[model samples]
Structures are given as structure tokens and as C-alpha cells.
Target: MAREYLNVRVDADLKKQLQKLAKRENRTLSNLVETVLGNYAKRKSS
Candidate 1:
């Protein structure tokens, strides 16, 4: 599948938290976000 970029503004605190969580999970920030969003989509569809 072709990939596209998404750009949005978020608060500094949220970004920092996400960065920390990604580090703990051994995933890049983008991968973490993609995983979370993908799971959310799956749940919503179900």
C-alpha cells in the first residue's frame, strides 16, 4: 500500500509522553502512533 504523511499540531506534554512511551515499547514515535490508530480503527469497526 502507498503511504502518506499526516501533519498536525499537538501539545508539548503529549508529545513528550508519547516519545517516552515509544521508547519504553522499543518503537519509533511514528510506529507507535500508527499502531495505536490501527487498533482504534479495528475496535471501532467491530
Candidate 2:
């Protein structure tokens, strides 16, 4: 799939929390966000 850049504005605290989770999961921040969004979309569609 061809990926496009997404610019989102998030709170600083949320970003830091996500960064920590990403590190623990051995994933980049972007990957973590994408995974979270994909799961959310799937659940909503279902």
C-alpha cells in the first residue's frame, strides 16, 4: 500500500505516553499510532 503523510496535533502528555508504549513494544511512534488507528477502525466497522 502507498502511504501518505498524516499531520495530527496531539497533547504533549499523550505523545510522551505513546512514545513510552512504542518503546516497550519495540515499535516506532508512527507504527504504534497506525496499529491503534487500524484496530479502532476495524472495531468501528464491525
Candidate 3:
């Protein structure tokens, strides 16, 4: 699949929290965000 770039600004604390979760899950921050957003989209579509 073709991927596009997205730029978003987030709070510092939130960024830190995401980073921690990403590290724990052995995923890059971008991958973690993509997976999370994908799941959210699936839920909303249902």
C-alpha cells in the first residue's frame, strides 16, 4: 500500500507516554500510531 506523510503536534507528556508504550511493544512510534489509528478507524466504521 502507498503511504502518505502526516504531521501532528502533540503535548510533550503524551509524546513521552507514547514513546514508552512503543518501546514496550517493540514498535516504532510511527508504527504504534498507525496501528492505533487503524484500530480506531475499524471501530468507528463498525
Candidate 4:
């Protein structure tokens, strides 16, 4: 499947923390971000 890309700026410390969290979960950083944003969107829209 094809996928689109998104680019955003975040604080350096936050970026490092996200990377660590993703590693601990054994998921790619991109996948982690997608899951997080997807959940947030679903909660807000309902």
C-alpha cells in the first residue's frame, strides 16, 4: 500500500522521548506517531 508523508517540527527533547518510547514498544517512530494521532482524532471526532 502507498502512504503519504507528513513533516512537523517538535522540541528536541520530545523527539528523543518519542523515539525511546517507540523503541521500547518495538515499533517504528512513524508508526507510533500515526497510532497516537489516529487515536486522538477518533476521540475528538466522536
Could you tell which candidate, 3 or 4, scores higher by lDDT? 3
Taking the tens digit of each residue's C-alpha lDDT, what string does model 1 give over 1-46? 8999988788999999999999999999999999999999999999
Report the Cα lDDT for residue 32, model 2: 100
lDDT of each: 0.95, 0.99, 0.99, 0.98
**Positional deviation of residue 11's Cα in model 1 after best superposition, in angstroms:** 0.9
lDDT of 3 at 27: 94
Q: Which stretches of model 2 miss by more than 4 angstroms?
A: none
Structure candidate 2, residue pairs in collision? none
* Per-residue lDDT value at 8 in model 2: 100
Clashing pairs in 1: none
Candidate 3 per-residue lDDT over residues 1-46, each given as its tens digit:
9999999999999999999999999999999999999999999999
- Quality of model 1 by C-alpha lDDT: 0.95
Candidate 1 wrongly placed segments (more than 4 Å): none
TM-score of 3: 0.97
Q: Candidate 4 regions off by >4 Å? A: none
Error of 1 at 21 (Å): 0.5
**Each model's Cα RMSD:** 0.7, 0.4, 0.4, 1.1
Q: Candidate 4 — which pairs collide?
A: none
